[model samples]
Target chain A: MTTPTQQRLSLIDVVNRCDSFPYPSDPRLERLSFLTFIVDEIPCGRIHSSVVPHIVAFNQQDRPVFHITETTISFMPWLADYDSRSDAIAQMLNIWRKAPKSFPSLSGWRDELYGVYTLNTSPLTTKGGAALAIERSACGIFGVHAYGVHMNGYVRTGPRPHEVKMWVARRSATKPTYPGMLDNMVAGGMGFGHSPGYTVLKESMEEATIPIEIARNAVPVGTISYTKLSKDETDSQPETQIVYDLELPADFTPTPCDSEVENFRLWSMDQVLDSIRSGEFKPNCACVCLHFMIRHAVLTPENEPDYLEIAQRLNRRLEFPGCKKWPTFKEEQ
Target chain B: MTTPTQQRLSLIDVVNRCDSFPYPSDPRLERLSFLTFIVDEIPCGRIHSSVVPHIVAFNQQDRPVFHITETTISFMPWLADYDSRSDAIAQMLNIWRKAPKSFPSLSGWRDELYGVYTLNTSPLTTKGGAALAIERSACGIFGVHAYGVHMNGYVRTGPRPHEVKMWVARRSATKPTYPGMLDNMVAGGMGFGHSPGYTVLKESMEEATIPIEIARNAVPVGTISYTKLSKDETDSQPETQIVYDLELPADFTPTPCDSEVENFRLWSMDQVLDSIRSGEFKPNCACVCLHFMIRHAVLTPENEPDYLEIAQRLNRRLEFPGCKKWPTFKEEQ
Candidate 1:
């Protein structure tokens, strides 16, 4: 109601509200069969698009058995019903590659394979856990916008609430997606064949030159999830980021050891928030940063009018799934 | 929608929808000027009843300045605008006490003083930093229902990753409050003249035998806010709990160190949740326990259909004020 200095512009708003896009309202998308993506016997996601033809063509290969109904497509309860879940996913990927117009390109650093299942469900606990597949993080934009884990590693000065600083990274200009955007000190996807813990450790070493000893100490503070609808409207991204905070000593400096990052800078909290407000950081990373800020009490419910909404929306209840209570993930074949 | 077994509860049907009292349609209460309770010039609550005569009487007593209007009553911005903020609050309390029928007894254990402010704002930062007052928590049920903070501490045994245990307490039967109601392992109101951090420490020592070393490691995970209308329809309670989780070792036993708690038991997570679902735990404590369950990954967003709704409702935005930008609270005389 008042002239807005920063009512809804907080990092949590831009990234979190993408879920507000109404998929249920799109008749064309709805007319398409809703294939529920399942894990641990729970339906985590659904194919909201008209991908029946693709499913049919891919099924012709004598792989991936699915229940074909007028209103839905469901993977059979048995993962062995298909030769291999990953192989079937690969076939779909092959189809997308053949017709670039249908599915967009896997962009930038996200070209690397990432995990796309409900976090850490297994055959011992789930009927079809063995059948889940993996894909490049970018492909999830068009494919199933699977719930993925994201970790942020930061450093502080001294103990006793000394001056606080955050380790921030700048994406390489050569990166195809979000190139040269501001990022957390260290961030990474829960790639296929990796637990959130493993991914954090791996990313700590690769993304920033953080030692295993320090990265292991990173506390899993909380998680933030959002359903992002990209500007081009080509894909819908439903993701859940498992957030972490690793406090470092006064002398700790994060050096970029991976090409994904152009450089790393230790910036004050004010500087980080300022950049976030100015839209310098990638949307999701900014949200990840804000998650840290709120948890750290740097951003209190008193200071931000949208604090309640931001906090609620930060973990928007997806009609989909999240990895909590999920069993430990199985090894990738 | 399906018969039973907790699906997404319609807002009207929430197990905890406490606003069932028909206040909006009640002309007597509606006709009240709805005096606003403001801190640091931010409106936090309103006197729901038509208490104009009482306000006028309190102001006549050579103390507490007030702005009386046909539509609202407001605190003077400066104590010089009155005698003193505490004096004004005391006068209001005095008026309520004298008219025993007008305002009921200060029931339960909340005769204790609590800080009611806009959070930690500074004199240089706020318009009325020095004009805030302390009040009895029980009185808040009728007065402003000021937002309060509650903390939860839990423990997990190392032997069985399959099993998780939470320390829960039973209030003494002889207590004035909801005696014998199951409470959090450590729960306390943010009293006047106390910071949340400082209060957590004080309550930890008094309620549980947790060593400071282990208690200091407690994490301020997040907060849960709710508005409850007493079943008897006498009062409306709006509260916000800043949740904490202090994990204890496998062998740690919580000894009730004070007479406030008659007993302490290390409850299994299932037992804790079952008690909550059955409403055996104090409503606020039950809600607090649920907050911990959701965070510890024991209650995944997947298994619980109401995960999103529960999460959102846990921090329902109050129509009144929240402690935002409040300077560190000044002590009461």
Candidate 2:
């Protein structure tokens, strides 16, 4: 009889897969080529060099939305306010959405809007300084900052990290992005007008069929950030994932309530590590697992060679402004 | 009845106190002036501009230890090997130690050596690449990366973040640095020849009188790094503190076993936060507490405005080299 083989991965390798960009301290970054996405004279995002011509094409439109320079693509000075800019961008995206072959990034057309705030403004606080809100799918194309909530739902068999088991979800094969990939039990984008707390509660119930009473216990932990340069080099995704931890009763099992998740499984720490090593987990989802392990002490300085670097890289400080406060649903109304 | 007023601080305020340096991504950093400390042509540390005159005085010696330039100070070509470099630096430091009036940083004279390594090497891996070792007290003067372990000893009253209470230590009034300030229950320097695991266990007992069996349960969670510029502009402290979390039995109480600490007390999360706000805790120690809060979900994305920034700042990636793998005691013997 043959024994089963186990796959292994270095902790740094797992982190590098998610945070693929060179470190900000690296000298090579000074020579890298990318165009700036400017709004109100503030450099807010990194637009891919390949996407410059497409943006320049928008400037030729009857009502030009953007003013294009050699190294920067900025909103026209006339479109100063939030609603005007949002409407102009949305109109442009809708036109691009019509031609799926030309603009592949707008294919999903997530109808949901993601707010782009300046460093001085947060969604949950003052509303005036918000630069614009655009379709969630277009966030990557423009290299704007995006936000989401990822929660590790787990059951504790003992007090130690080794004894803890996590509830992992498998995305439905029919889903648009990262289909059939492993993911956190409860995960959702922080769409405009919703807080991380609200997103956690909403996603937990919709995706996992978890009761609100049980999901209310989901505690907001910290965040994991990365600027993932798409494999094709056409998209730059600078994202912040607000992480949470929910300890569920061992007796209660999670069942897929929506088409988003294919199934859920209670996995041991070893199984999680093995799956991560084998590349069965989504890059960001794997990063979320690494964050969980670091907090739970399953991965420590003794066992992990890149403990400090991993911790720092997991929460990379993005140059573009992000929402310091997540607007609650009640506040939005 | 009138209630006692409680001191309060924003989480960003606590993190800013430790990571006071301009971020590496900040444009203003390019204009900041400092000289790089070069070891065997590898940029290893930062030297305060004020200390350049003193380093120049050393070059006037019959056998100069360093080759100085306007922007950088490099070790002399004659001192090519580890032993030669270590001895030459030590000799100069000893002379400086005699006249503490001029070289105030050498006054502590702890006699513990800190190894300086290139980015390509670690103390636990190849031993030959260690450029030199110098007294710990003078590490800040040279701006070399120093290491330490800080463990938070706490008791879990419940599963929630606020349900835990920490064992806080008050440093002795007679202590040279941050005298009478609040600190973690157990903390100690990661000397030249010790791993973080060994340091945590050793410090737990020496500082808090914790038993070996109990101390061994301290789980290494993560690390907090900062580049602390001295108030007088005389020293640059780029240090990394390996952080651990120890959940003690509810009945167990920590007692001061060494003269470093005057007393220990179990403090509520509120009390700890208040103390940190009141400036009763050392800057780095307060950062460790914030790290605990972030991990335990006390300070979350919902509650802290600077949640992402604080998390990133707490683990600032040092430009200089640090030991990736710490040397075990067995290896040293």
Candidate 3:
């Protein structure tokens, strides 16, 4: 009897015996990071979860410096102008904290938001005053997005901070593709030459039954930039991804019209982080989103008053001239 | 964002909730093991390659014991009797050594052989007795097979076992199923109450360019039995499977008439196994058949020549009333 190794050899030699001709002018492929959220049970207690931002800043020796604070990691890209760097970072945080009002809103101050952010890195240079070079040559803007929904705080009886009931629509078990999987509330590609906001809005309306106006209000949070790798040798260009954060009510409900979403549910901050750690969440993008929330302390179980105090402290920490401490947790209010 | 635990809970709760009302059984609701070959490359020196079998013994303990070996496996029910076990095992080894006088030959002999052997385990008892319980139960049988002409031994310039000239019929990638898949020989299970030999023969003729007489002489090599699990209260009854082994001439040539097989090539054994490992050879019955092959070393390279020898020795060892090394491979081999 032929062994598995033998069988595999036969198939491989037969299938790949012929020399493969290279195709010129093919678009370079890239690898990009996607974020998603995984909410566990409804918030019921003071949940403690560790946060790890995807971004890493390397020192002279290419070593990472760990920083923990009350909210948000301190790994923002450095700008040539110190003031501009601080301003840009503040703007990004503001977008994350308060849902941008410029975008449309769900009925009665309820809304879902999705956004994309893009950034590029400059090559290391000996000259100190060199102009900041866009990393576009090596990395191209590919996609960015963020989406959120609002719900009444009554979904769970515990302390509520404007509950944002969010659930990933389970992919249909019979779906022609990605069957029996998890899907995000809103999904879109940046380089597709389509508007991420518009795409997410359409996706929200079609998938989660969120009203069109509510999806439109999704504000641009901060832009997240990352590089991607390519699987094909012919395509080695790096792809960049931009991300935006949005806010929603706690009591909001989603009515799925598409069969892709078998069902949905709500989760507490602890449950969400636990699910992420356990690898139970679907649609990996959801896990990224949840990670962001944890790192920012945006989904803690604290009541509104406590949450406000925590948020205030976080804001103060970010105001530090050279805040090395990545946000760890807000002092108990 | 909802967590995975929340999603799992919701799914479980929904299923439980629906269970309150008696539900009708779906015809497709059956325990199915999908098997396929993954061709991989390994260093074997002058030996070229060897076949290893992986077995999934269903309902053995509770989940199933996946046993791997370097011996041929079979599942023909006719060989269930202890007396037939010896001849059956010998016949299987013979098929591997000497290809039967059939067109489309046993190009996929390893897969078929392994499949049959795997099916045999379902009827094995804890005491290692033949558990032919499946004979009294209703069962469905189906198989998807393919002949990889490029995988034939003629392609290799090593010690030429036989001078066989053959071509493969290419399958259409546009076809609804098994698109672009190579096929020269294929056959599968006979539904309950049907003649296994007749069913396989019909399939051979239909899918492979083999003569009926040669197919008939393919011979029954061994029997694989499965034992049902009593722990699964959800599944009221247990199930079993049995498979047969056959061989064809090394020099056999085939002319595929089935549109499913579009093109053909003559490949060495190395190529064939490689294709299976690499997933280039996609057979319709891959799931179950592969499962069976893995369980039973129908055509394992290590035991190809000595399967009969080993089986005979095992029988001899069993005959010894007070054998100390009963279950050990060292004593048996």
Clashes of each: 13, 0, 140
* C-alpha lDDT of candidate 3 relative to the true structure: 0.30
TM-score of each: 0.59, 0.91, 0.22
Interface RMSD of 1: 5.9
Q: Can you write out model 1's per-residue Cα lDDT over B161-212, one digit (the tens) per residue?
A: 2246887898999887678988888877765555555667778888887778
Q: Write the per-residue lDDT of candidate 2 for residues A251-333, one digit (tens) a residue.
A: 99998998999999999998898889887888999999999998888987767767877877788778787777766557754
Ranking of models by DockQ: 2, 1, 3
Candidate 2 chain B, run of 10 with poorest lDDT: B120-129
Weakest lDDT window of 10 consecutive positions for candidate 2 chain A = A120-129
Off by over 4 Å in 3: A1-165, A174-178, A223-251, A282-287, A295-333, B1-333
Instruction: Single out the weakest 10-residue window by summed lDDT for candidate 3 chain A.
Output: A315-324
Best by lDDT: 2
Expressed as tens digits, the lDDT of each residue in B148-173 for candidate 2 is 99999999989677689999999999
Tens digit of lDDT per residue, candidate 1, span A1-333? Answer: 223464436554565444444444245444333455554454545554456677776767554566566645666556532235555666566666666565555422244554444444555533233235556644444345454445555565543222468888899998777899888877776655455666777788998888998887675545666666655544566776766667777677788897999998888788888878767788878887776676665665445555545665566545543333332434422
Q: Judged by lDDT against the true structure, how good is candidate 2?
A: 0.82
Q: What lDDT is reached at residue A62 by model 2?
A: 79
Greater DockQ among 1 and 2 belongs to 2
